[model samples]
Every structure is written in C-alpha cells, then in structure tokens.
Target: MAHDVQLEAITYETKEEVPQELKEKKLSWQKLRRYDSLDLESRSIPGHHHGHHSKALTRSLIFRLAFQSIGVVYGDVGTSPLYVFASTFPNGIGNNDDILGVLSLIFYTITLITVIKYVLIVLKANDNGEGGTFALYSLLCRYAKVGFIPNQQAEDRDVSNYELELPSGRAWMASWLKSALEKSMFAKQILLFATMLGTSMLIGDGVLTPCISVLSAVGGIQVATTKVTQDMVVWISVVILILLFLIQRFGTDKVGYSFAPIICVWFALIGGIGLYNFIQYDPAVAKALNPKYIIDYFKRNKKGAWVSLGGVVLAITGTEALFADLGHFTVPSVQISMCFVTYPALILAYAGQASFLRMNNDLVKETFYKSIPKPIYWPTFVIAVLASIIASQAIISGTFSIIQQSLSLGCFPRVKVIHTSTKYEGQVYVPEANYLLMVACVAVTLGFRTTTNIGNAYGIAVVFVMTLTSCFLVLIMIMIWKTHIILVLVYILIIGSVELLYLSSVLYKFDQGGYLPVAFATVLMIVMYTWNSVFRRKYHYELEHKISPEKLKEVVGGISLHRIPGLAMFYSELVQGIPPIFKHYVANVPALHSVLVFVSIKSLPISKVPVSERFLFRHVEPKDLNVFRCVVRYGYTDVQNEQEPFEKLLIENLKVFIRDGFGLPQSVLSNGENGEEIMDVRQVEEDMQPAEIEREIEAVDKAWHAGIVHLIGETEVVAGKGSSIGKKILIDYAYTFLRRNLRESDDVLTIPHKRMLKVGMTYEL
Candidate 1:
C-alpha cells in the first residue's frame, strides 16, 4: 500500500556538491527563482565540516583530556570497590572458593564487557563523535530509511558529517535487515521503543546511581566508629545528596577541575592499598585471573554463583558513561586513561579484597572497610565519600544532557534548559529535572536505607542498559560499518551471553527491590511514546491539509483583503506550501502582512549547524507577491542564545540573500555578521536594474523598523469524534495535560506578549 501524501506538495532536488559554473553566474530575480529548486547548495558556506574525531591533538592536550576523564568518566566505576565485595556476599560467603569464583567473574566481566565490548568496539560506533542510544539511532537513520517520522528531507542527508560508507561485498544479512526495517512500520516502532527504553533505563540508572554510591561511601562511617548508627548513615547520605545536586548549577568547568585531581589521588590510593593487601595478606589471589575459575565457580555453587552475578555486575556500573562521555573527550584520551590507570586499579582492588577474604571469611559483609590498613583508614574514608559524590554528580549531569537531546528530537516534552556554561556546549541544567532528581535520590536513600537493597535495584537498570547497547551495536555493525555476518555473531556469542547472564540474575531478584527501575522506566517510556506519537500525527495532518498555491493566490487576491504595513513571521511545521492555519486566519481577519514569511524551525541529527548555512530561503510563487518560506535548521546540541533576537538574524540574512542573489558565495556577506562590507549591485547582477535591488533592501529595512510580529499557532490536540475510547483517553487527557503544563513556545523564545500574535487552533487526530 502506498503512503498518503498531499498531491500539491512541492518537491525540490538537493545537490551535495555545488557546480563551479553555477556559482560564477549572475542570476536575475527570475533566474534566481529557478535556481531555488537546487536547495541553495550553490552558496559556498563554511561549517564544522570535519567529523567529530577528525582533529589532531597535541601530546599535552591528550594527556590533559585523559586526566580530566578520570573524574567525569571513571568515577562511578572507580568507586565500585566500596560496595562490590559487600553486595556479592550479602548473605555471607559459603567458603573461600566462592570468593575466588566471584573474583574471577568480576575480572573477566570487567575485562570482557567494559574493556573489550565498550571501550574497544562500541565506542568506535559513535555517531560522528556523539555516543548514546539516540546517537546510534541517528547513525542508522542516515544509513537506512528507518526513522519513525516521515517528514525527514533529502537535504538533511547533505550535512557534511552525515556520511555513509557502504560495504564493497554483497552482504545479504545487512541488506535484509535494512529492507525489513524500511518496509515495515512495526519494525520501526519496535526500534523506536527499544531506543526509548534504553534512554529511560539510563535516566532510571541516573537516579539509582547517586543513592547507592553515596550510601555505600557514607556507610563507612559505621565501620570507623561503633557509636554511629544506620539511621545516622542514611541521614548523612541524604544531606550529601542534597548538597551534591545543589552544586549542579555551577557546571563541570568549575567542579570538574577540582574533582580530577581528587579522583586521581583516589585511584592511586586504592591501587596502592590493593597491591599492599595482595602481597601482605596472600599472593595466591593472583590465580583468580585465570578463566577456568569462572567455569569452576558455576559448577560448584551452581545457582548460588548464578544469582551472585546481580552483585558482580555492579563492578562495571559506569561503563555506559565511558561512551556517553565520548563527546566531552577524545577516544584516544579515554582509551589511554582506561588502559593505563582505571583498568589496572580496578583489577588490583578486587584482587586485594578477595585475598583479604581468603584469611578472614567472617568479615565478608564489611570487607572493604575492614580490610583497609589502619594507618590511612581515615584519609581513605574521606576520599571515598568525595569520590562517590563526584560519581553521583557525573550521572546527574548526564541525565540532564539526555533529556535535552530527547527534547530536541521531540521524544520528550518542553523543559527549560539552561546552558550552565558559555564556554562548553554540552553543559546544561534543567531546573525542574534537577529538583525532581534531588527528591527521588533522597527518597531512595531514606527508603532503602541499605546499599544491599539498592544494589539489587541498581544492577537491573545497568545490565538492561548494557543489553540494549549490545542490541543497538549489532544493528549498527551491520548497517553502518558493514561488518561481515560471522564477525557480528562472534560478538553476540561472547559479549551478548555475558550481559544476558547478568540480566537474568538481576531479573531473578526483581521481587527484592529490583522492580524500582523497571517501573520507573515503564512510566517514562509511556510519556515519551505518547508525546512523540501525537507530535507526529499533528505534523502529518498539517502536511496533508496545507493550502495549495492556487488557493493561496486566491486568498491574497481578494478585493476585500488588504496588506498590513509590517513583516509577519508565521511559524509552522510545514516546509512546503501555505499552512492551513494561514488560510483560516485570512478568512476571519481579512488582512495579511505586507511582507510574510512562513518560518519552519527544524532540528537535525548533527551536533551543530553552520551559521552561514543556517537560514534557507525560497520564494512563494509569483516573486512580486512579497511572500517567502524560510527553513531554519538547528542540530541536536545547538543552543539558541536568547540575547540574539531570532527576528533580527532572519532579517539580516534575508537582506544578504536579496542583495547578492543565490549565486554569490556566503563569504561575500562575511557570514551574515554585522559591520561587513555590502557589495555593489553593479558588481553582482548585470541584468537587473541596481535601483530595483536597492528598493527591495530598503523595503526590508522599513518593515524591520516598522515592526516585526511573531505569528505562532497554538494547537490544542484532542481525539476526533470517531476515535476509539483508548485513543481518546491518550490524546484528550494524557497528552493535553502534559502540553498545558510544560514550558510554552513564547516562554522559550522570550518574545514579549505585545509583539507576539498567537493563532489558536484545535486539531482532532
């Protein structure tokens, strides 16, 4: 069956590389209108054209990034030493063999899952330099037609960094998978659900990580003195969590610098202590590095060892951050820090704990604190608490980032995103999200009260996220990298099996507090899915019911209607033809703006759009009508500064377009910034009279000085009369409630009420 699309929709061809001859010609207004069908590719615009990893780094910078990554990327997993041993034997160890077996599992799991699977393989699959579930989805969408929304344009593929490299050989599996995803809407929905589920699990993980990490670190207070009670520990954790979240407004530049050195000292201290304990207590603990111990562990303990994986998987809790933070640091820097510092420190720490367990089996519940040497116990305890706080801060910031990305892609509701640092692009603070997280973190700390119960909940979110990453990676390997079928299966058999084992163990403990994250993620998934569904349905409706060119001409040509004396920017989601809301406005109001622009704000999959190429302009047919369509594109990570008024920028860019025509290079306008030289009309166009171009520029300036009014369509989405009960409930109730409460468009744009004109409409989808 063919998809239903409006027959009157205008289509344009986009070219990747502009022709040199076309660039040299001087185009008249009539000729310029003809060239508009080329989608403005002739303008020699400069952008961040290189891929994310294309830049070269100095030795000092690489080392600096590696050092900085210690605090931001490795904190969560680094602090895992404080709780791993205690969580593993919550019911007490059966014997020394169980210790050795669990130690072996930890060694291989970290080595295989965190080191080999993530650092070496999955990090390479990053979308241009960004990593996350959505980053992978963005990469796949570039390679195949698997996006859920059907409004993606051909010109979006012309982005400099949106590159694809097809395999030379005929890989049947890759072809088949791509075909299935494109042809079936069911397959696309499943893919979107999986991506949203993974994202939700990460957010859920964000909430649980701070609770468990802070509690485990503060739990050390009990071991330090006999007077401290469990209630005191919980209260101290709550206090620390509140302070940690309170400092998020300061951003990473202020906080991350101080944290790096402290985390560096923390890793060195733990590694040194682990080495000391390994030799002083028992050198035989080195034997657990052998893989055979893992196999023997399962044979003897059987189900007990299997169930212990829920605790064992906690060793690499922050593995996802390694990739998620790749945008903040280079791959070489992350690899350097992991291989030389973090990987070895973690191994020795676990080995030392296992060695101490061999001689003192009674201290299994308090292994980390009890095993610490007496001389540095207090200092180590202090550093442990600070390190856990830093770990919590990292995840909290990451949650804010993912939510912002979701908002940009239309999968999440509108939230006020404050760019916390002017220097850094990724540092953002969402006040509502932060306050809600603080409350949730405090609630989890008070409710669980113990790290063991929280660990059960923590492992489910972590392992499930890991499993989803593996699933996305398999599809990425096939579709993006074009890897052979055999190599892909080997990855599944090795990495996939280990994550499944951990996943099953975590699910086994679901009744014992593991359902917290699952329940949280389920709620988040519904909200995200509901928002995206209605968002797309509304866009589809606009596309189908848009006013055709003939109707648009008739509406404007009426004898009763008159043109107002200013520019009116009609904002809508449609890129082609007049939006139906405009026709409705003309019928009731009987007047139109002298200069009209149908502005469509779009978000792309790339990280940033070049300023020179930001504003794309096309004439609404009948060039003398003084009507145009402008599509402004922003990337997912791009931030629009409120200080720079959107209307002023549009007017300035439009002037450059009218003065230079479509054939001139963008460099001629000095990137549309103010105080640049304006070219003489005689130098650019020989056919058009110089006076005519001057008049157009003067009229645009007059319109700007006269007034600029933003015409935004306020939509109320409800279920149609013939809709089903379930559909009505979802659309009329749940969707309506969320839309009304979240941040509105005027608030985001900061437009004053006097200058803004809102056209309200109701849509029954």
Candidate 2:
C-alpha cells in the first residue's frame, strides 16, 4: 500500500503546519501500539532503505553474530537429538500400540511447530536486517510515534547534548519523528528493556544444548564401549568444549563455508538412515501417524505419556533461535534453508530413530550407536559427532548475536564488540560474550558432572522462551494480521495448551534437576532487565525555547539584535572564572565581545514531545543580565553521539531567552559560569526525568576535560553489564583497525584514535 505513495517532503503553512506530529490515533481494535516488529527505524538496515548491508564488518559484529549463531540462535535447537528419541520411546512409543502414538506426536510436532511455526510464521516477523527482541522493540518505538512534545523529551540530565537523527526513508518517519519529540519515550524504552531481558535469557540456554546433546551422544558411546569409561566420554565432551571456546576469539567466516555443506551431508546421512529404518518397520508404526495414537497413549499411560512429552518437546528445541538469528539469513534464505536442508534432515532422523526403537523392541538407551552395525556405527557416530560439533557452532553463534544485539540496543552494558572481517557481515565476535559462554559452557560440562544430567536440565529454559515467543506470535496474528479474536484465541489456546503439556514433563523433571536451567535463566533475565534500567543514560539536548525562531531568523535576514558587531557568543559550558580561551575574546585583542547568551536547553531521554505545539511558551524562563539565559526543554530520546546542538536550538527559540541587558533577576544555566559542583553522574534515567542542576554542573566539568564515553565498565548503569574489560576489548583492538590504516612505526602504539584519548575508565571487560 505504501509503495504507491511517493516519498515527497511534506510542506505545511505555519497555520496548517499545526506544528503537529503525523501519527495515527486509530482505534483499530485495541490500538496495536507499535511493537518491536513495527518500528520504522528498525524496518531496514543502514544501506537497506535504497539497497542493503550490515553497518560494518567489524570485530564486534563477528563476535556477536558468531556467539549468537552458535550458542543461542542455531546451536541449541540443532543438537536436540541426544534424548529426543530415547525419552519419546518406551511407553510413549516403545510398545506396538504406543509406537504409533509417539511417532505421530513427534511427526506432527516438527511439521507444525518447527516447520510451520518456526520456519514459516515466527521467522517472517523479523524487522529489516535485524531480529531478536531489542531490534524489534527499536522498530516499534521508531514507528509508533505516539507522544511528541517538541524539545521537551530530548533534554536528558546526565549528558545533555545527544540528538538522534531519524532517517527520512519510511512512510511514517516524519510523523513518528514529530510524535517522538513529545511522548511515548518510556513505552518504547520499556520495550527495549524487555527485549534485552529476552536476549539474555536466550543466551543462557546456549550453555545447555551442547552439554545435553554431546552428553547424550557420549552416553550412547559409553553404552557400547564399556571399555571406554564414562570419564572418557566426559573428557571428550570437555575437549570439544575447550576447542569450541578457543576458536571463539576468531570467527567461522572462513571455516563456516565448511559448515553448510558438512551439515548438509550430516543431515543427508541422517535422512537416508531414517528412511531405510522407516521402510522396514513402516507397517508397525503406520498407525502412529493417526490422531488416535495420541488419544490412546494419553488414555493407557497418562503419567508416562506426560513424562514422555518432555522428550517430545525436545524435537523443536531451537525454535526461538530460528527467529533470533533471522538477521543472519534473509527471510527467504532462512526459510529455504530450513525447508530444504534443516527440516527434512531432522524429520527423517526422528523417523529413523523410531524405526530403530521398533526393531530393537526394547528400552535402547543406546539408540544412536546401537541401532546399526559396528563398522557403520563408528563412521555414523563420527558423522553424528561432527553434526553435534556443528550444532555447537550454531548455538555459539546465536548466543553471540543475541548478546551483541542487546548491547546495540543498550539492553546490556557496553562490551568489547568486534566485527570479524570487513568483508563478511555474518562474522562478529564479542570478548565478553565469548568468554562468558566459554566459562558457562565449561561450567555446564563440569557442574552437572554428566551429559545425562544436563539433558534433564536443558529443556526448561527453552520451553519458557518458546512459550513467550508463542505469545508474541498470537499477538502478531491478531494485532497485525487482524485475525478474528475467536480464531486467534483458539490458535493460542491450542498451541499453548499442547506446549504446556510438554513443558509439564520438563517441569516434572525439574527435581531431576531441570530447575537448574530455569533458575539460571531467571537470574539472567533479572540482570539484563536491571542493568538496562540502572545504566540507561539519555543524551541531553541544550534546547533554547526562550528564543523565538522569528527573532533569530531576523538577524540572519539582516535585522540587528544589538549594537554588537561580531557574533561572539559563549554557550553554557559554564567555565569557572572565565578560561583563558574566553579572555582572548575580551583582552589584548579587545574587539566588541558582545551578544553573549548562556542558553540552557533541557532535553528528554525519549521522544515525548507534545503534538499540539512546537514549544511551550508558558514556563519560558527568562534572565536579566548581559548574559540572557533562556531554557527550552525537548523530549526526544535514543539519539547518541553527536556535536552539541546548543547553537542551533538557540536560533530556534531566540525570543524566549533574549533579554535587554538591563537591571533584572539573575538566571543561572545548568552548566554556566556560576554553576557549582556536586556529585558525579553515573548514568541518566531511562525515563529522562530531568536531573538536578547540580548534576548538570558536574557534566560540564567532565566535558571540559573532554572525557571519553565509557562504553564498557560503566555497567553499573547498563543492562546486563559485562566485564569492564568488555569495553576495553573493543577500544584496545579498534586501534588495530585505525593503525592498519595509518603509518605504523615500532616506536608508537597503534589503534582507533578515540581510544588514545587518556581517561580514567578501565579497559577490557
């Protein structure tokens, strides 16, 4: 529908300009209230508006993407085979009558949930080149454009000079920008915070998948090779764990090419093996495909059936990762990959495992190795092991991506994020994320003491994630697709009910120790959520609401404000006792140092500008001395890193701050000559409640020293704060990129010049 509408710049007569933000207050049902999926800024990548691209192939991107891709995004879900079969069979599908029941349940679960719900439905919801919660939340905030009140929202108290530049590429950019200037900053920020919580929870799941899969696989190996002690299997799992961690500092871009084809072959072998077995016992389990099997299994062995659902739920373990990693592959590409490669391979393997169970006619704790010949078994085992390794890679990659994304959206504390190569968008690395995963994975390998135990603990967190995702899906189908309430309700009820049944099984296993993971996830969620709240600082804009645009334009239009000859104006840097720089303006050279105004501009953290007017003229604080101080408050938020906008804002509201240099009340700017020192500003409030004048004075002092923004180590104020070294990791390495671009001499250290600036902050989280 928007394609037909040309992208013409809208012009309004000051009368009709209404100075209004273009937003829709449509009562379209319950007001969809723009979610992460619907935001305009997040709707496309940097080059994507006209074309497309990831911002840069930097080390941070490599670490982030790789970890997420391997850890949470793809790995966990891929390695679910360890217990998928064992737990699903024997009582659930082990017997003749029940074989069909278990098989049918597994078959349908994959087809509907993994294939349809994941590959088709959930993955399609990705916003632009990014996916996951924070990315989605950003998109929603950008597009919703609900509350806007001029400059009132952008004036944050901590760092009062940040302004976000909204790209004018989408259908509602202008409207959203206007609304953002007024209100709804908190709502959008809240969503971002929630999204971060989601990412952290997602990553915690990563440490468990490989531990469970490899552990389960190893258990089977031990069953066959009794000569090989369980310790040997444990050692093997540990070694693989070690290798996975070591390679993380680098990325799989070069090695990843080997990933696809190898994984493909692995799946093919699985599919072929499954097909062979299915045909042999095809008749025995044919009845399993029917709905009656589910009913029968539930009726005859209710408790067992419930227990088995835990294993059944394992089939779709990585469902959420499918959506989280949507940024890695385009919608069509991921869909194709899942349908043509991932899905078939998984389904056939499950079927093949079922056949093996039928033929064995017993509780085969060693399905993966025992179902086949010894010579074939070893090689097949190798293939499956290789597959498990690949699955691990995927989980690692996914975890990296989610955490990196969390940092980008300020959901986590700033960490050392490095993109792997300038050429590959997929290659990313995060020192903090990598080290943490490595530590957690190692802990996972050792803590549970066995993969079998890990398996019991693995499915719970994923179930929680899956349930939340399902809720989002229901919202999309109903809110965006506008499906009938009844239909949406029915779909949610059905999916949720079935999911709960499976979750119950896992929950039952909690005492068997599944609660360990759930507990871990809960803690992670808390950290992520808390940090976002505490460390979230908004960049403040020094808006000049006192000055009228009309008055400022008059001067640029040749009208005169005073007898002052030159434009020598000092903004509210509020230096104590007039620095030598300003003295230069008054002393020796002694030119007409007139037209000085210490303008104080207040800005809101998020855009919450009022839609009705451009600026509030009422509380317009005016000053009386030769230094006329006028203050304009803005509500715009989410903008970071830019030159101070004091001069520009002053021009916009000249009449409000300007005063005839006569006897009058003294006005003090937040950062003015008269401003006094107070306490250090840790971080700005996420809500942008204007900080006290005392904090502003301190900010000016820090600004005078030209302090570097601490991306890392300042986690006391950020969500999911990483190591102080996290920021150091990026800053230290960033110099390498810049050094590579500059002349390198043995006598000098090389790096991103930004890092060279001396500061008190610690490096390398």
What clash count goes with each model?
A: 0, 119
- Return the clash pairs for model 1, or none: none
**Global CA lDDT computed for model 2:** 0.49
- What digit string (tens of lDDT, one per residue) describes model 1 on residues 580-649? 8888788788988788888877676665566666677775655556777787776666666555467888
TM-score for candidate 2: 0.61
RMSD of each: 6.1, 15.4
Q: TM-score of each candidate?
A: 0.90, 0.61
Cα lDDT listed for each candidate:
0.79, 0.49
What lDDT does candidate 2 reach at residue 304? 83
Off by over 4 Å in 2: 1-78, 89-94, 143-197, 537-765
